[model samples]
Each structure stands twice: as C-alpha cells, then as structure tokens.
Target chain A: MTEPKTAIAIQGLEKVYPGGFRALQPIDLEIYQGEIFALLGPNGAGKTTLINAVCGIVNLSAGQITVNGFDHCTQYRQARSCIGLVPQELTTDAFETVWNTVSFSRGLFGKSANPALIESILKRLSLWDKKDNQIRMLSGGMKRRVMIAKALSHEPQVLFLDEPTAGVDVELRKSMWDQVHELRETGVTIILTTHYIEEAEEMADRVGVIHKGKLLLVEEKNKLMKQLGKKEMVFELQHPLETVPPELCGKNISLAAGGSQLVFTYDTLQEDNGVTDVLDCLKAHHILYRDISTRQSSLEEIFVDLVRAS
Target chain B: MNFQGIKAIYRFEMSRTFRTLGQSIASPVLSTVLYFVVFGSAIGSRINDINGVSYGAFIVPGLIMMTVLSQSVANASFGIYFPRFAGTIYELLSAPLSFVEVLMGYVGAAATKSFVIGIIILFTAGFFVPLEVKHPIWMVAFLALTCVTFSLLGFIIGIWADGFEKLQLIPLLVITPLAFLGGSFYSIDMLPELWRKISLANPVVYLISGFRWSFYEHSDVHLSVSIAMIALFLTVGFAIIAWIFKTGYRLKN
Candidate 1:
C-alpha cells in the first residue's frame, strides 16, 4: 500500500493551456487522509484548474500528483479510481435514470456493478425516491444530490467537490453540510474549492487560499481566523446618541443600532488597538452601557482582507 | 482494460438505441421499404436485366450496404458527439479508461447498431425482392466489415467535429452522395468508357459492387480489389483515431 497518512501529494503541479494561458503555477502541497481541505478563491483563481489537473480532467503541464500513493500520470487508473470529482457544472445524461447514471459512474471507475452499493448511496443522499426518475425531471437540488451520489458510488478514498453548492438554496446547502459531515465520518478525504468563505469556515478543517494561480496560504481554519482576525466591540447603550461623541469622532468608533449602541473596530494583533482609549472616552462622556460584546472577524472578512492585501 | 467500463459505455449507448427504436430501427426499415418501392418496383419494371440478374435482386446488397454505411456513421458519430456536447465527456476523460477501451465501447456499439439495421434491411428487402445469396459467408463478412469500418469512420468524424452541423457534413455531403452515385442502383459498366474509369475513383463503388457480387457473384470491380480497399479504409480509420487520441484532438486540452 502507499503512504498511510497522506491522501494526496501534489508537487510542482502546473497547467498551461495550449493557447499559452498559464492556468496553474508550479506548486507543491499535500492533503492528509480524511481531512477536509477547502481551497478558497474567487472566480478565475486557478482553483478548478488545480483540481482538474490532479483528477486527470486537464493534463498537467508539469508536476507530480499521487493519490493514495499512485502517480496521477503513470498510474492514472489506480489514482483516478481512488479519486471522485463532482464538477461545478451539472452535466448529466438527461435520459438516464438516477440509479443508472450513478451505477454507470461506478463502472466508469472500473468497479463491477454493485446494486447494493448504489442503493446505499442513493438512500444516503435522500435520492431513493428519485432513483428511477430521469435526470431531466428532477429539481436542481436533487440533481446535485445525484452528482454527489455518483461521486460516492465507487467508494473512493478522496472526493473533490468543485463548488458543490454554488447556486443552491440555504436549506439545501445546510443539508449538504450535513452530508459532508457524514462523509467525513466515513473517513473520506474531501477537497473542495469555493468562493463562498462561509462554506470553508463551516466545513473545512484547513483552508488554502489560492489567488492568481498561486497558493497564498494554508492554515487550520480556526488558527487562520485567530491569526488574521480583527476585533469588533459593540456596546449596547441605555441611552440614544445622535452622533459619535466629539472625543471619539476621529477614532474607529461609530454610533449604531439607531444611536442606541456604540461600535468600535480595531486590529486584534496590535499591542494597543485604541480599545482602552475608546472605553476611557465613553466613560468620560458618561456613556453607560448595558452590555458589551466582542466579535472576531469572520473567515469572509479575513478572506477579503487577504485577497485585497495580496 | 477496464472491462466493466467498456461494458457500461456500450450498454448505455445500446440502451439509447433501444429507447428510440422507432428512429433507430423502424425508421431504417421503413426507408428500406420505400427504396424498394421506388427503385425496385417502379424502375425495375422499365429496366432490362444487368448480368442476367433481376433488377430487384441486384439492388439488395447495394441497399443493405448503403444502409449499413450510413447507419454506422450516423450512429457512431451521434453516440460520441452527444456526450461531448452534453459535457459528460469529462467523466469519460477522468475515468480509468484508455482511449482504446473507450473506442471499443463506442465503436463496438455503433457497429452493432449498423449491423442490426443492415440485417433488418436485408430481411425487409426479401419481402419485396427475390433475393439469392451465392455466398452467404462472404455476404456476412462484407456486411460485418462495412458496419465496423464505416462506424470507425464515423467515430473519427465525431471527434473531428466541433458542432452538430459538422457531424452531418461528411455523411451528407460526402457519404450519401458517394453511395448514391456508387452503382447502388446501376452497374458502373453501363456508363461510358471514360465514366466507368472515373467511377473507379469513387471508393463507394467498390463497396457496393463487392456487396452486390456476394449475392449474384457478379461485380463491376474484382472482389480482391474491394477487400483491399476496405482494409485500406480500416487501416486509415484506425490510424486517424490513434492520432486523435495521441494528440488529444477535440477530446483533451
């Protein structure tokens, strides 16, 4: 068997289109077995290109990719068989039933027909009711579920969900989150790319930020938020203020909540982020607060700052 | 080899054909009946015998060959093309399959489809024409080869095509007209000396002539020459398909 820990190892991976467009720069990274790694990026950020390169959908210009110890190029069969990809586009055979298409995916991966496995997958995705229905007749959310079922049909070691919930509704997206959690329970290494930072924050154990064909940073999701996160202090006031106090007018302090609260934004990493000054000023102004709460910057804010700074 | 993969693709393609049985099977059979009515009944009544074979019997092999060739190209071309157009080709590309295995799945299904249609036409022709096969083995051989070879040709066309219109271009502008003028209805020998020599340049003439010979044991061209031409087309088709896979033409990039 291959390395027991590393699910995927990509070294010096690059993709240059025939038209001379450089889609991926030379990069090296490794994903550990059973970890959910979210590659976060905006549109045209080479996230899909990198995923496609490793999945054998796009031939790599240069690099080595090994999935479960099989080289993606030299041992493509073993490597690809171990990897399942749910592309962003909802492309499926309109005429085929859900069961047939999902079973067909298993066969495509070189697995023998296993009706039981297909049944289990369909049932898991809540698609058992629609298994016999044609793809064209299904709702968009159900089709997405079918795509996931197809990816899981072959019992792959690694699953790549490319923008899995790109246009999905909130309820379905929440259900999909549960599905991802369940897949994690089954010990499948999941790597997904998305511009939706909330998805990364909610689903990822680790997050890799890719921008302009380059991997900028990869860190534990919580650690990443803590490292770059800013602090926002909101004080619920007992009295209303028409505007910012003259003493706090030039500071990062503002009136909010219909003048019933005072908000302060500051850098958490700074030795002194003016929080004391703002508090002192509020006290001097005889501002009595009913409650005070601090909120850390979300992954979305950190991601925006990272992309903007880069 | 990914035997399961090939079987899956093959089964999927065949299922499509069965699902549209009217267009895939019944349509070809109906077209064959129409050809028999128009050419065999109407034209045969006015024309004299060629090489002592009745006009109705003379066109059977040609008709079958025509149907086989067209159906093979059409079936194979559409089978591959639809997956590409629909963007499901990504699954095929990402699958654990060699291009050869993929070719086998698609081309095998296409050839089988054309073969079935050809047999149906042959069986349907018997209802209208007094058919006789002097060499049943060669007839089967010719029919099988025509199906396989033309399907390979169609597979190539499917890959080379970027749009639906291009898929029909070669079959319509090239194959259909060539088959019509390839002595499917009349022998090339009945033409003027210069026209007969020029007709020799048309490859379909050899295909139709050789097919007709399997029934009546008479042909405008030698059977050996016809076999050689088919072998050449198969080699060319296989070579082109190999090159396509190697270069990743319209398939990968």
Candidate 2:
C-alpha cells in the first residue's frame, strides 16, 4: 500500500506558558492533503494556540510541527509561505482601501505584484465594488471578507481559518462555506475551528473534537456520526397520572409531568435499540398513548455531550 | 527584509498618517508658527546675536529639530500603537513579512513625515526671520539622520507601549521636556557654567547643537561631537529595536 501523503504533521505538541499554564498538551495530529478538517472545540480549548504555533505567531514550548516537510520553527519563512491564516478577530489597517489591503498582504508574503489576481479575489468575495473604500468604512461581514482576501492573496496551499463565521449572518455564512468548499476543490487543504457544529457537519470531511486542550476524538465525519449518534422516543399518555409506575423504572424510561408522558433514550447504532421492549411493556401494562415521536441526535447534541463529558 | 513588503507597509502607514492631516501636519505647523511669533519676536530684541547669527535665526534650528524629534516619535509610536489597539498586529505577525521589514516600513514612514514637517517649519520660519544655510549639505544630512534616529526610537516606544496613554507618556513627559531644556528658545552659553554642563548631559542638546552649527557655522558644542553622539544614539536605538524584534517582546505575548 502506498503511504498517505500528509500536508501537516504534528507530534507531541505542548505549550506551557511561564505562569504555569499549559495551553496545549502533547497533541498529535496529521492532516491529509486537500482535506477540509474541522476542529470543533469550546472556548479556551487551545484551538487558537495550536493554530498560532503552526503559523509561527506563538513560540512552542516543546513539540515538532512541520508544514509540507518544512519545520515551523526552523524553516518558518518557508512553512509560513505555504500557509495563510485568517485570525478570529477582524484585523486590518483601517485606513487602507480594500484593494490595497489585499495587495499589500500579498507583498508581505514576498509575492510579486499581481493586480489581476487581487482583482479576481476581491470580485469573488463580493468586495470588488467596495475595493476602493477604506476598510474602516466597511461593515462587519465585508471586513471579514477582506480578511479572507488578505489571507488568500499569497495563493497558499493550506489555509487556516479560526472561527470564520462566528458573528456572521446566515447568508454570508453559507457563502463563506461555499468559498471554502471551492478552495478545497482547487487543492487547498483547509483547517477551520468553529463552535457551530452544523458547519462541521456540512463542510468537514474529517472532524476532530477538542476539549480542554485535549483531542477528544478525530475520525471521518460520517463514521463519527454513525458511531456516537443516539435516538430519543417520547410518548404522550392518554390519561394524566400523578406518578410513574414501577414497571418502567428498570427500563430507563422517565416519567414527564405527572406521568402524562414517557421518554426513552437509546443508542441508534444498536441493532435492538430497546424501544420495542419499552413499548411492549407499556402495552402489556395496558398503558395507552395518544401519540409517539422519535428524534435522532444531531451533531450539536453529540458535540454538547462530548464537551460535557470532558 | 522584503522590499515589496516594506513598500506596501510604507504606503499603508503613510496613508494612515496622512488621513489625519489636520492633526499631524496643520497642528504642528501652526504650533511652529506660534513659536516663531512668541519666542522670535519676544527674545530676538533682547539677545542681539548667538554665535554671530541673529537670535531669531539662532533659535530656528533648535525649533526645527524639536519638531523633527517630537513628530518622528509621535508618528512612529502611533503607527505601531494603533494597530495593536485595533488588534491588527496578529495579521502582521502571521504574515510572511520579517521583523526587519516591519520595522523599516514603520520607521521609514515616520521619518518621512518628520522630515516633511521639519521642512515646513523651516519655510514658515523663513517668513519671520531671514534665515541662511551655512552648509546646506550638512544640514540636510543631519536632518535626515536625526529624523531616522528619532523615528527608530519611536518605533521602539511603540512596541513597548500597550495603551494610547502609555504611548503619549514618553513623548510628552520625557522627550518634550528634554527638547525644551536642550535650549530651543535660549542659548546654553547664557546659562551659568554648572547649569551649562548639566544641559550638555541632555542628548537633545547634541542634536540641537549639530543643527544650529549647520545653520550658523558656529555652536556652543563642537559639530563633530554632536554628530558622534547622534551616531551612537542610532546604534543603541537600532540594537534595542533589533533585540525586541528577536525576542518578540510585547508583539507576541
């Protein structure tokens, strides 16, 4: 079998500040080429720290990180040349025009002047019309697009977006995702961190869950969903009762609101999810239900559960 | 250092400085004119000559140097401080530009601004006193050197300062007082021997002496010593800035 090519390789990454705070703890990860990798984590989970370390913004306390075989520290310029980072905050020289900002960012990366490329990037981001306007005059969403334009100016092979849509509107969020998807198609490996689980579900080929500076799990998106997803069944009683009967106790069924409703939670991956047994017992006890409904756990539910567990 | 990066950054910083033209250019020009009015008219009649030049012309170099130093410091410090305040330093840090590129871009823009303002002040002074340049070449050279030195010093201050108030603290408290005490409006020779020696301890005194010597061809301090002090200041200033960049002080953390 051929060896899998890696775009980014990190081993035993650790970042400990001088004040005894361990921001990152021995993280090991490998990102494949041209893959959309989503790092899902809550606040203070060291997502930014990891990204900063890879981009050479933050010095590493201990670890090895290489970008396309270039060491992040030793070959910082080469490694940085291959990666474009759009930080979480909207940061740009406010007095500069949108066009100037993008072009200047390209120059900062040692790229020659390419007005044609910059123009196309602006048009793609819907910023062509606003190209001559000062960045301070732009709206929040437009400023966010300018950040994207700046990052893309160098034509980097790998792009890291830290919460690209944290405060964006719904339409822009979808459009941003589309742009990300399009970039991936152009052979750019994209790594993004988002609190929005739907973004990961809709966009990520591989999902890595980070909690409290630790990698909780990393797997293919569909595989992770298939492995951890659960189902819930709720029943409305025909007649309201003051209390639950002892029969449903051992089955893990919970009485809701004076026994008027019963709730059952089960793992969806199980062949026999125990819903049938619970219904059988209810029928055997002559309990009548007016209605029944079931719901499958979403990525949001799984994410919440994983974060809560950690 | 990438020249393209430096040019891009220089253009960006220049536009930023120019955007507040009323404050950066007009305010300084107006203040300089006012200095020529208040000090030149009031003191020129009392002190007949300073090193064989009219008192009005004598104070011109000191005033111009004062403006150059303060404006260079203000421009460079604010150039770096505002980006940090607006949280744009992260963008610069993550970019492929090296530290040297960043420093040169900011300091170059700052020196340009101060140099422009210094010329404006000199012209504005021309309207008041009949000024003559004894050595135009040396004058321009010292002007450029002084602007560069102070601009680099301002860059260091910008990197070290965390807040707008802190940025203002050094220029307002330390640099301004030193410039004033360095004898922009008066000659150090008029002071007592002990006081004159104490004033020599001020670095601004050398800058003023060098500038005054270029204009009058005579000065309280030797021209060579002034030039030497400015060179030493440049060396020390560059060293501190390079060290800060290497350590990523205030920039990274």
Which candidate leads the pack in TM-score?
A: 1
Per-residue alpha-carbon lDDT of model 2 for A61-98, expressed as tens digits? Answer: 88999999998877877888899999999887777899
Q: Write the per-residue lDDT of candidate 1 for residues A1-310, one digit (tens) a residue.
A: 7754999999998888888998888889999999999999888989989988888877778989999999987898999999889999999999999999999999988899999989988998999989899999999899899889988999988999999998899999999999999999999999999878889999999999988898889899999988888889999999989988788887888889899989999988888889889989889989999999999889999888888888
- Chain A TM per candidate, in order of listing: 0.90, 0.94
How does residue A142 of candidate 1 score in lDDT?
A: 91
Which numbered prediction scores highest in DockQ against the true structure? Answer: 1
Stretches > 4 Å off in candidate 1:
A1-4, A236-262, A267-274, A284-290
Q: Is the docking of candidate 2 incorrect, acceptable, medium or high quality?
A: medium
Chain A alone, model 1, TM-score? 0.90
Query: Which residue pairs in candidate 2 have backbone atoms (N, alpha carbon, C) closer than 3 angstroms, thus clashing?
Result: none
